[model samples]
Target: MTDKASPGYADIAAHYRRLIEDGSLRPGDSLPPMSQVKEEFGVSITTVNRAYRLLKDEGVTTPRPGAGTVVSERLQVASTGAARLARIARTGEKYAPGETSVDHIAHLRSCHDPQVAEILGIEVGDEVIVRRRVFVRDGKPAVAAFSMIHSRALADVPELLQPQPFDRFWQEIYTERTGHVTTKSPERRTARLASSDELALLSVQAPENAAVPVLVLVNVFHDDQGPLEVWEDVYAPGLWQVEGEKP
Candidate 1:
């Protein structure tokens, strides 16, 4: 009402945000150079900088050393399409395009952790198969996913012991192997200070041993038999959920 016609830095930020959400500007896609943006928007360089900073803080963009400000890899879900994001949120499925697992580890491990035991519907000391992966986009780590399956299911899903990620979704592999489709996948979300290990794995930037906030998303997958497996995903900083269904 005051001055709708006068474009401001917020307008600049919103323009790029829309492009990112709508898949026009995807993960690792660089934004227009500051000078070019300033010329197109008829704004000062300072104004353009402010807008870029705003986008960066919103996790919509990241500044690369030589590539300029590019879309954040974790936000690839936004660029992939909101419906796809919703689908992934509703059902644990494949990662967005361009997101790849850069590291994978699978092993049989003793499970004495109470929460892990409860999620897997196993005793505190029961052994479990643990599969871990570090997913990245544009060579930057975005999420660390840990999957735990009860040891008894090993015979049914021996692939869980494989060192590499399956060509198909793990959920699909499990379903095909056991004839138990996922009936329920309850998720629990929490925020906590990133651990030293998480900071290193997720490439979180922080002062030496300083606390950095992170979001932990845990999904307990259930089938007709009972709890099938549990996935604990840790997202890097700036990967928190935001409002708006689109993007």
Candidate 2:
């Protein structure tokens, strides 16, 4: 869940993302040189330049005259994930219908992405449902989210899919219908630029602030039944705040 992208430049960007995520690379940390990457990955200067450009475009790195591409000192949103969600909910945006402006759409279970598989603790081709949505506030795209519910948990609750789709949260509906106590909720946060998929889901134009920052807050809601829902939200620039935690 770090900056890990696909292969090639994506791989390189992922490496930096992991470094930052793991606290190995902090804000103002100098990334390795192109020559070093050339020596390490045995790629051409052009390829390294492309990778660096991608990171720069993603606002993970910035170029300076005296210094090279150093990590940008961004606003670190270090608050607890629940705290952030509670803050949003307190703003009258719980993301529920009538309570908030969100385009909620549910998709059939897919097993193409490894991240999805890993998140749901299922095989690569197993069945899992995803909810894709974009939350609008003040008529502007404020948040984009994807919530995955393992189909195994829904096998007994077939009514959840019927009657023109439930308007409430999946977790709430599940607990209400089955009386499952959703106990554990552990979460973490990360920052990255909105990808094309995220942008399309949120239906937003690109990069108004020279850097399109997305604050990703991922939380897994669970009970005795193991993870019931794995939800990840990517927040737009203004609607999300960034702060640091005391050590």
Candidate 3:
């Protein structure tokens, strides 16, 4: 049993969180292993696991595929929808907070998922183009977005097939390429537990006997012709929102 005065998981998690925030620990920095941390803190491995899990949940640290858990390369920042749109309008880039992305991915794939097809206003089993991107802030995986475009759109905007970030927001690219201006983008929000693949992608783990929940934001872009694309953004858990104080 841990001594009554011994440090707990929160203490450990906070210690690392502060270090990462203060630049004492830089991005891609490895955190001490459970065994080492257990010895230093005089706690069991379980305690260390809990602490690490907490840090992951908060996006302070992330699990690298071949490497162990390390300080996240980005941190998530939450802003109003209007604010996000304004940023995208002024800067052609989305995510990276304006930094060059090292992991932007775009690909063409067929869609058999009915949910995705309905959102795109197409029949089930229709083929679509998928663009996958992981948005990082401060150094953590903030959001993973999958943009599904109908194959027909590619005849006009072939740039969507490129495996990288576009010079401008994709919607703008669509308009300039096909003159199909985006009239509205309606979004739906939901939450669900992360899957095994998601856990790895987000670089976070769930607590013992429980799974991490992700906020799913699905946006369907539409123009005069009809639905253009469906963007599904999966947000990591424990995202922080900035609030303005009343005078």
Candidate 4:
């Protein structure tokens, strides 16, 4: 730990990161129990929990129900843009012309969602360039996505507004126009009920009971400086798998 006192969750997360980097801890190693950490760090259980969640979000640790939190086999010490681009590339060029795939539609919209607004550091209803698309695999809709970019960021590149959906990778377009490639891919995966828009986009009949839990991929694209784009992707249940190398 540094001379500065570790105060809150951020401090606790940094402290753990340092331990991992200094070889004080290794991958697959279990962290001390929450009670132990609280005693050692002199922080509350909630603070310790927050720190653990932060590590989990950064892919540094995994929580086991009875065993406690363990260092993840895969530790992403730093955000590298290459990893995300490579993952996208590995998806392969499977979509062909006349494949009955979803189309990208351009629409006038405002960024109002609290989370999105916070990521963009802008107020609600701020104008943003919104691109909507659906992913159809094997003739069935498997995913739906809505990406929002600050209009001012891509204002000069009017060609980005083309009607052809998914024709141009948004990351590539931004990199070419701004000379700043997106390097950070922070993803949030969660399950939730399908909204009316999602139901319409997926072309699925709405169930009378609770909507099935779907995986939502919210990726925030950022450079070393800050965020560039925020994408909200909704995936059908059991339709996709995410695999990454452990190094």
Per-model lDDT? 0.72, 0.62, 0.69, 0.65
* lDDT by residue for model 3 (174-243), tens: 7887788785454466888877766666678766557677777766778777778887767767775321
Evaluated at residue 181, the lDDT of candidate 4 is 66
Give the top-scoring candidate (lDDT).
1
The lDDT of model 2 is 0.62
* Lowest summed lDDT window (length 10), candidate 2: 91-100
Clashes of each: 0, 1, 8, 1
For candidate 1, lDDT tens digit of each residue in 1-247?
1443656888888677766654568888999999999878777999999999988887778999999999887663222222324435544444544556777899999997898898778898888998888877556787777888878678877877888877656667677877878754545678788879878888776799797887877667677878877777777765544333332
After best superposition, candidate 3 residue 116: deviation in angstroms? 1.4
**Residue-wise C-alpha lDDT for candidate 2, range 1-247, written one tens digit per residue:** 2324324766666566545544467678789888998667766777788888977766667897777888767622223335435443343333322123456666566677787578678888877777676655435565676777778666756644442334444556567767887854556778887777777666767755445667788778777767666777787655433331111
- Root-mean-square deviation per candidate: 8.1, 13.8, 12.9, 11.4
| Model 4 Cα lDDT, one tens digit per residue, 10-33 | 777766765554346777788888
- What is candidate 2's TM-score against the reference? 0.53
Count residue pairs with overlapping backbones in model 4: 1
Better of 2 and 4 by TM-score: 4
Model 4 gets an lDDT of: 0.65
Q: Model 1: residues >4 Å from true position, as ranges?
A: 1-97, 205-209, 242-247
